[model samples]
Target: MTDNRTDPPFVADEGPMLHSWLDWQRETLAVKCARLSQDQLRLRSAEPSTMSLLGLVRHMTDVERYWFRNVLTGENTPGIYWTDRHPDGEFDLVDTASAEEAFARWQAEIANARELSSGLPLDLVGKGLRGGEEVSLRWILIHMTNEYARHNGHADLIRERIDGATGE
Candidate 1:
């Protein structure tokens, strides 16, 4: 909890409102990267570790695709981050990738997610990969939201280390 005041959960009035929250987390993750210099954004969080904010942005972009359309909806589209040669390449996108390119990719990923999730009904059924089980559309929304929340925290930490900036 960032503060003693905890807000109530989003009302179930509309789907867009709830999804906006999910988008908010991703936007907040980008917030930490917004004002940094390209050099700063490219700098690794630690030596020999390529976990820069840029990398996180790309990873989250891949994550948005993985969860929304691929896994939950079973699109089976090739994943951006999962490749045979470098399974963990998502974490190693440090230098040689500019902040502008990273932001552009993130924006595109979020756009794709928004489009994919737009038509899903609240109670829509999706077959999950866990033992080939089925899950609710609402559940996937919450799961995606939670996934964004967790990674956003990591983004916050990485941002603070980058230049002492913090929040959301």
Candidate 2:
């Protein structure tokens, strides 16, 4: 895949630095999934594990919506790939999922997240609560960076297994 990730800045203010890293992590996952076939995107990582490139995309879509819309702005939105009855639906129900649709939703959520958080102070607490505790914009940015980094690691392995492709 042609990598389009913007390297995180080495010297910058806290907000830009955090956002750059988060954006970098986001692009990392996209790079891993790029140029793959539908079946290839849904290839499972291993037995008993439903993790796949497409699953990661679906999962991140929900993650962005949860943090930015539901938690950040107090919007009561529901999961796109999961529910109480199927907690792992994002990964488990990917056998026939549409890669195109998943990517579109994921990108849209990312755009919405950017708009919601733009120019908001890092120390400003969100309107919603996570685990019944107030969370700051700074914390959300850090948490999201960590979340994407962890998942991109999985994407790395899955992509390699699918086509022997590997990179940062």
Candidate 3:
């Protein structure tokens, strides 16, 4: 699969820098999952671990929705793959999951997140609560970039285990 990920600018303002890094991380995850079959995507890192490429995609979908829609925009949207009964459903429920659907939802959520935050200043406060305090869009962007970077590390290992493929 074509990785088409763009490098972040060497010098940029805060918003552009944050979005660029986040976009790079998102594309890195996509590259890790590229050209893999649905069954392969469902392959766990090891026994007793539910992590997988598909699971990561699903988890990020919910993460995007939580921070951008539910928290930032106060959209009252439910999670895409998580619930009270299955908090880890994103990872645990991938046995028969459709990779196409998962990717589509994830991409859609990414677009929505961009739309929701496009006009708002980075310093603008969000409705989302974290540790009993409201957060800012800038904080959410940084947090999400960090989130994807951390998860992409796991994705690197899993992808290599799946096919001996490795790289940034």
What is candidate 2's local distance difference test score? 0.95
The lDDT per prediction is 0.72, 0.95, 0.92
- Winner on TM-score (1 vs 3): 3
lDDT of 3 by residue, 92-141 (tens): 99999999999999999999898888868899888867677888999999
Per-residue lDDT, model 3, residue 1, is: 45
Per-prediction count of colliding residue pairs?
Answer: 0, 0, 0
Alpha-carbon deviation at 57 in model 3, angstroms:
0.2
In TM-score terms, which candidate is top? 2
**Using Cα atoms with residue i matched to residue i, what is each candidate's TM-score against the true structure?**
0.81, 0.98, 0.96
In candidate 2, how many clashes are counted? Answer: 0
Q: Decide which is better by TM-score, 1 or 2.
A: 2
Q: Which residue ranges in model 2 land beyond 4 Å of their true spot?
A: none
Q: What CA RMSD would candidate 2 show?
A: 0.6
